[model samples]
Target: MALITALGPITIDMYLPTFPDIAQDLQVSSHEIELTVSSYLLGLSVAQLFIGPITDRYGRKKPLLFGLGLYLLATISCALAPSFDMLLVSRTLQAFGAAACIVIPRAVIRDHYSTQEAAHALSLLMLIMGLAPVLAPMAGSFLGPIIGWRGLFAVMLVVAVLLIILCIIKLEESLKPENAVKLSAKTISSNYFGLLRHRNFMAFALSGGLGMAGLFSFIASSPTIFITQFGIAPENFGFFFGLNAGGLILGSQISVRMLRKHPSFSVLKIALLLGLGCCAIGLLLTLTGLMNLSLFVICMFFFSACLGVINPNATALALKEQGGRLGVASALMGCMLFLFGTLTSSLVSSWQTGTTLPLFTSLFVCIGISFICGRFVGRA
Candidate 1:
């Protein structure tokens, strides 16, 4: 489960360090390379809309295998992409394939655990998933010079193959026969729209989604910001990125410990408020021109830590309210994440003004709205 969950994060982060190289090799601007990221996220969101229902009807193992097969092909396409446009398309398809990796595990978790247990399980998963962010960029940076950006995609191709093999050998269907629902257009529509009206679910989903968007805002902008603004070398960028990711890992472990005593909902509320405080400090530092690399890293570390608390607890609370049809519920939650991720990442890319103000502003607004949304959870 941890390996499957980490697939999406690794795919997203590993290539991040090669943004400049990709842009240069493809004769595109850095902004254009960023579009590939946005495209991948958009594809992730859209694909989950359909994949969720399919998983519910077809069972987890079949759909998961199918998605992994598609992901493997898409990775090869990405490796051989000759133009920026081709890379954009390939990345989108790769996301389509990778969407299963994001959705199925949450559904499986929902199948086995209650709210708190699920959160604890997810926190453990996050400990493993967290390593992707810490390691992927560093690996990318080191390998990029040796093999070029295309070689990085080639590496992803190998990883995808390994994941496919691992799934075939070890992964079992978690979706029970009794829980299976028949698929129909109307059924799919009803399932999805019903979730839309579910206030508690929507609250936690959007709260978690917006928090994820804030995180992606950092991910999308950091390469350009660090390399261009801070004059950090491409090879060295991963160290700083890893440092902030360490904060995220630390926070997840902290939440794991907190869950031993406190309720997930209570932890979520406190974490959201604390995240807002971190955003405020980050914004203050950015606006006052005191946002050097060291201070920026410090502020982001705290904010990332807050996310560690927010994501698992929010996910658990939202999933807890769904009595059945967890696949669709989990899919929608994952969709919300990538949808908001697509929006914030694109906005951060376009809003670049030679300062960190836009990034901080986006982060603050996301966390603030997330807090507002958090208030509505369990109220219904």
Candidate 2:
């Protein structure tokens, strides 16, 4: 479950170090290749939008296996892509296939566990998933120089194949027959609309999605900040990136502990305020021209840590009212995440100046707006 969940981050961050390499090799601007990230997120959102309701009707196992099979093919396509256009399309297909992995695990966890137990299980899984992005770029940085950037997709291909085999052998169906939803376009559309109409769900989903926007903004912007702006060596880029990922792990652990003593809603309030604080401070430093590498990394680490706290709580709260249709609810949450991620990632790239101000300002605005919106959740 952890490995599959981590695939999304691995697919994303592992390629960070190779942006310039891929651009040069493909005879395009680095910025052009960055569109692949946006396209992948867009594809991911599109896939989850449907996959959730499909899995709710069918079982977890079948849909997951089929998706993994497609994932393997898409990854291979990425490795063999002959042009930038081919790579972009392949990456989108890759995310579409991968979306099944990301969405199903949440529903699966929600299946057997209720309320608090589900939240804890999610936190534990998140702990493992946190390490994937942490190590991915570090690994990519070394791997890219050896076999070149295309080799990274070959690695993900191997992973997808292994996961397919593992799922076939070890995974079991979790959704109960009684809870099985009807398989129809009309039914799926209705369930999704119902979820959207729920006040608490909207509050948590939007806030969580915006929180993710902050993370994606940082992820998309970091390579440029560290390598291009600060002139850090490409090989060491992952170490700096890992700092923020590590913050996420630490914050997740903290949230897990806090959940023992407080409700998710209580923890969420603190996390939102603290995360916005980190972004605000970073913005101030950036505008003052004092955001050296160390300060920038520090602020981002806290920013990610705050997300670590916010994500699991928000997910738990959003699905707490899922009388059924856990798949639909989970799908909406994950879809919103990448949809927001796609928007934020595009903004970070498009807003690029020679300095860090745009990235900091963007992060501040995302978290600040999310915090305000979160406060309105569950109100009369």
RMSD for each model, in Å, please?
2.1, 2.1
List model 2 lDDT by residue over 83-181, tens digit each.
Answer: 999999999999889999988998888887776777777788878778998788778877888978899988888888889889999999998888899
Global lDDT scores for all candidate models: 0.87, 0.85
- Clash pairs for candidate 1: none
Per-residue C-alpha lDDT of model 1 across residues 222-316, encoded as one tens digit per residue = 97889999999876877787777787788899999999999898999999999999899989988888889888888898898889889989888
Q: In candidate 1, how many Å is residue 189 off? A: 0.7
lDDT of 2 at 227: 97
Model 2 scores what on Cα lDDT?
Answer: 0.85
Worst 10 residues of 2 by lDDT: 371-380
